[model samples]
Target: MHNATSRELNVDVAIIGAGPAGLTAGYLLTKAGKSVAIIEKDETYVGGISRTVEHEGYRFDIGGHRFFSKSAAVVDLWNEILPDDFIQRPRMSRIYYEGKFYSYPLRAFEALSNLGILRSTACMASYLWYKAFPIKTVKSFEDWTTNQFGQKLYSIFFKTYTEKVWGMPCDEMSADWAAQRIKGLSLWSAVTDGLKRSLGLNKKPNDGMETKTLLETFRYPRQGPGMMWEAARDKIVATGKGQVIMGYGLEQLAADGEGGWRMSATNKDGDKVVVKAGHAISSAPMRELGARLHPLPETSWNGSNLKYRDFLTVALMVEGEDLFPDNWIYIHDSKVQVGRVQNFRSWSPEMIPDEKMACVGLEYFCFEGDGLWDMADADLVDLATTEMKTLGLLDPAKVKGGAVVRQEKAYPVYDEDYAANVAAMRGELEHKYQTLHLVGRNGMHRYNNQDHAMMTAMLTVENILAGERVYDIWCVNEDAEYHEAGDEGAEKALPAREQVSEDQAAALNSMRDVPERIVEADADETAADRRVA
Candidate 1:
């Protein structure tokens, strides 16, 4: 059913999106001698949110990606793609609250010193009180965090920043998320480590065994993450068995009535191109995939209900020395709308073309089409400049120029209903379309890091080649644990489909948590209050 105006391609596999997940699949498929056509909507960039944007000789990292993964295969693949570009950089970030900067990972001594003796005493008392009477049935992020680090400390350090990032109250978020994100360290452990460091007794180097949040160093590409994907694209093309088609967006995906997939994509110019493949690997948002399917599956309605959070970055160029040495600073100060600030030079000297000048990116989390997302580029730049001055991190007079970049569907929202919805979609899709494989963050609606995304694609490729579900990709990086030390792909031995018990599979499919909307009653009250005011 191809139109005369449309061009068609035939391949063994078709890959959607050119992100780490999609490109990883395409590269591996082609290397294994399978023909693949990778489609990317963006005309210029390859990496999705991880891309580096360049303007007037300066580069900006969208959200400041760190090249660290617990999976050795992911680490090795990164090295293989961009071998000589990798550089070891010290990890530095801090929490800025009420005009004071505190070390991240909650350094006991520094946090206590910054908080003052009275507040510190209260924090300790609250910690002890919670320790004695911990929440018996922890259900929400607030409950889990309060139990881990006293209510006082949680309010001071965890509440405001987390709310800003997720646009929801901590009480509504799932506790399982906190267990995954802030795992390992606790109030007692932090205090113990702080005292040892202060007394010069903790001289151990970071052997990749430390908590993920406490890692002192990480690797980075000399330019930015985009370099890695671009290289992957080039290698894929060199193979001649693969082609990366840019400026094309998926319009429709349908079964060809012969156990093969026929995908239709359109470019900005409205020109259409089609690819017919035996299998399809998608990294597109689950909601979008559901909508575009022809003869949509039974549970496609569940996919339509999935939600996402969007992000935008405002990069400012300043004429002076770098503002700070840290890679980025978490803005826990509720007064400012900017959530975090990234120092480009700190990421890599090459990211900033000029040594005499500095480029810093201000990150803002917002829903798509919201006020921030709709703001004019010029106004956003001005807003970023003013906020930087207010944070005492920059001087407006020193700013030379600025630019804005918006990324849609930057994060998958994990509301209370998300787990059920994702499960429903997976059940029908896996049963009805065995050749269709979902991978990556938005693909699976999982809030995983780049490594987790890559692992999913890696396992999917294995399943595809074996002509059977040899590995259950959903179980890869199950807890999202960040391990620093391991051989490449050492722990990537994922469970096979037949090997997974029903209970284990259910637990594995449980979606990772993000913020959820408050109850309807609470939402109505808040709206009423706003209207009254």
Candidate 2:
């Protein structure tokens, strides 16, 4: 592969990573007439975690994500990209807790009544009992939920699932995750609201704030979330001032004394090019960016400080199967070790091949080298089949071909000491260069959902357009206490000199093409010859 041109091209912005964040930034900036280029290392289409995998006409999203953010800007962006594609569909999800299926959002009365009136009354009594005497210490996410809802309810509805997600004991995990996820929800609120409606009580909050039901109906793309980003990519590229360069891996970054940085990249096509950017906003993980920049100081803190967890999903092309009703299921049984399972067709019928068939993405979350990641492919299928059957999900026999996708650095883990170390590195990078800005989950070291990620990208680009020295990537999500409303008016803060100089903005753009480093240095589970448990 040869260089398209020996021209030393320079632009106002260069976005790293093509996920929702990077794509959203590119879309907004390009539309604003800022010349932009999105650099992605993967050979596949960009969506990052929200990306869709297409095999034999069957589509599988890396994780089960639906459109449900309260952010107006995010919603507006969604509408702008796929206005017609927004399908207001009902969500049918249940929790298989303690071998019983409980309606998610924990329909208090129904769940209690089903457990028998005695237990139902006890549940209500205990719930009221706990609320009357709230726990003073809100330790972990589990503690916060239990204190609010009661221990029994917490154990049943939240404990297992939360443990599966963070891979930590409920008591050990942070309450912040719970607050961001489930703090405002309550049985009392749901009951009073439902009873008022059942018995003609007070009017409800707007359709969005109906707490009893988290999302009675939600939005989804006809294809997958990728459908929205792909469209944005096309529009951005069509602008003629911007281009999304796929498979262009970042190799190194060399900064000129004048504040501009040069990026050397080796793309998938094996072509090498230097991207001279006026400003660079990266949506990839920050640790990876740190490693990619050569001139490896004989010492670095990123070695084991940051860890990447890989995601494995097997898209089962069943023999005309209707495996599960929910769009997804959380797996918490220790015996199985699978994090969650998704019913892709539940999001849309288009995810499957034929009208009569079904597609299930069995998700197994594992670190780089746990024994499970070292298994054979056939064993993996067998394990998945057995586990699904054990959990009463999949019948051991009705399966067909299995398509596996293993992703590394999927989730950024917040361990005991990660927060301080990540901040230290980011602090150094902030004063070190003008061209680089880390935006997405990995980049900012924040556990942001897809909407948050997208908003980060949008904000970064907004900074470029406004010529403002805006909030850094880390502050977008982690800085504020996130209410369910999402990061709405996050940019009110301003200093006397908030605008970036023209040369400062241009200096910021040239960090593209430097080989983006892959951090945590985990082994590639997908490449292993062995596949299953």
Candidate 3:
């Protein structure tokens, strides 16, 4: 356990975690000529959630996360790091609704037709009925979605897979989650969109909705989502403004007493070094962060405080043509243990050797010590292939090679108890560490996708550098609500949000004018920020 190093390096800012948030922040800090070092616990990988893995001749991502965000700044930042490698690719998504796949954005015609004429007519009738009455007491995510699209539509398009994603019944999950993710989405908008598309009066591409009704395209890295992070790492390090030290685990955090922070970390090569920094930014999980503080917690958190679930990925290399027209498929059969299947081969043919062969990742939701993660790699691969065949996604007769990788804390579960506890803990951290900022998916323990995670990372770095320390970084989750009895600090936090975006006017307009996005500003903050109230 005695890991030591004579390298003895220190920096002005020590970024903990090399995921999108850490990488982006470190890159920005370095670009600003601030001496920065990115210390990560895993030596083997630089891309955190976005990292790509190669097995034999096949390459796979835990999930094929596409790059598409309303945050153009983040998009430009990504392209700058991986310029020519960025390609505009069409995005195709759907829900495994009612035993049949339906368009994800819910195409008015296709969606109604998919439900079949009878059921579809009934749903439309219900939607009209709901429009008249509306949900007066919408609380949970399910309730909100049902309110917008009606209960029939919610059960078909939202219930099962949504349950699979969160590992919680839709009824139990917070409505804030739905509010944030589908903030501006409305059934009325969908109808308007479909009519416009039919009449060819759809909003022009440059007008801002990138393939609004169509969802025409998304920009993705040539290799995978990891490529963008890797490029950012390279650019930041090459600028001599940042240092990305992989295989370094945070060992200890002690105040330097002179107003900075002293961070001790262990690297993968069995070398340990203590770092000193003027400030610190963390993209690590809040749950582990609590225990990892200088003085350990007096007791492990009882369930009432914090809770999260983990995920597993089985990357299957199949010898076949296109598995499906989609870049991925949702395994909707409740009988299957897997939640989703990502066909990386569909991402790009060159990602694999030949069109004759393919690679896919079957995703399963599980806890850290769960039975799914306990299985051997080969066994897990076999199980994934079997389930894929059951769903007709993969033909077992053509499986070439398979590898499995299990990711712990892939998603932060949002149960009713999570909100209050996360708030209390985040408040304590913010008060205790002026320079410490928590960001990214696990960093704030919110169910944020890659784009949101990267956006969070970008904002965090900017907020600190801009001297906006009191900025609400915890509001990035889907389920954000007002937990305040009074609005003392809410009046004081205007400066931070103003500094976060160049187009503050547009952000405020879109946020304020949209009824669904009523709590949009706060929802984009970290879970810790919202729950602290």
lDDT of 1: 0.82
Tens-place lDDT per residue, model 3, 271-319, is 7777788888888777767666665433333323566677888987778
Top of the candidates by lDDT: 1
**How many collisions per candidate?**
3, 28, 18
lDDT of 2 by residue, 38-69 (tens): 78888778888888889888898888777765
- Measured against the true structure, the TM-scores of the candidates, in listed sequence, are 0.86, 0.76, 0.76
- List model 1 lDDT by residue over 179-237, tens digit each: 77774455676566666777898875322124453567888998988899899999999
Model 2 per-residue lDDT at 436: 67
**Per-model CA lDDT versus the true structure:** 0.82, 0.67, 0.67
Segments in model 3 whose C-alpha atoms lie over 4 Å from true places: 1-7, 96-100, 107-156, 174-212, 267-270, 295-304, 459-533
Off by over 4 Å in 1: 1-5, 121-139, 143-151, 179-214, 478-533
Please provide the root mean square deviation of candidate 2 (C-alpha atoms, Å). 9.6
